[model samples]
Target: MDSATHQSLLNAARQVFEAKGFTRTTIADITREAGIGRATFYVYFASKEEVFAAPAHQVRDQLVAAQ
Candidate 1:
């Protein structure tokens, strides 16, 4: 999958995770929000936890670059 698609998944996951919390959120919830297939999510992320960390990692990397 492309970076745009991967980003979409992460965005969708962030929304769902915020709304439903980690325990309640499922892959289907994220996929539905992203308008993508469940399989597509797997192409970008191994699990919700990994996806959740992606944005944090991005920010951390940016901060490190700035420093």
Candidate 2:
């Protein structure tokens, strides 16, 4: 997938995950937050859990870099 679209989804998922928490957030919630359809989300991610990891990894990297 292209970086821009991929980044958009990550950003959206991050917001939803933060606001709703992992257990409460759904793929539908992430897609809606990204302004993309459910099928489009599938093209990039196998599941909400997969997408959640991307942002979590990014956060970890950011924190590690700050130190």
The number of the candidate with the highest TM-score is: 2
Off by over 4 Å in 2: none
Error of 2 at 29 (Å): 0.7
Say which candidate scores most in lDDT.
1
Predicted structure 1: lDDT: 0.90
TM-score of candidate 2 to 2 decimals: 0.86
- Measured against the true structure, the TM-scores of the candidates, in listed sequence, are 0.79, 0.86
Residue 66 in model 1: lDDT: 100
| Residues forming the 10-long window of minimal summed lDDT in candidate 1 | 1-10
* Cα lDDT tens digits for candidate 2, 1-67: 6687788899999999889999999998988888998998988999988998887887899999999
Candidate 1 Cα deviation (angstroms), residue 57:
2.3
Give lDDT for model 2: 0.89
Model 1 CA RMSD to the hidden true structure, in angstroms? 2.0
Question: Roughly what TM-score does model 1 have, to 2 decimal places?
Answer: 0.79
Candidate 1 lDDT, 8-54, residue by residue in tens: 99899889989999899999999999999999888889988898888
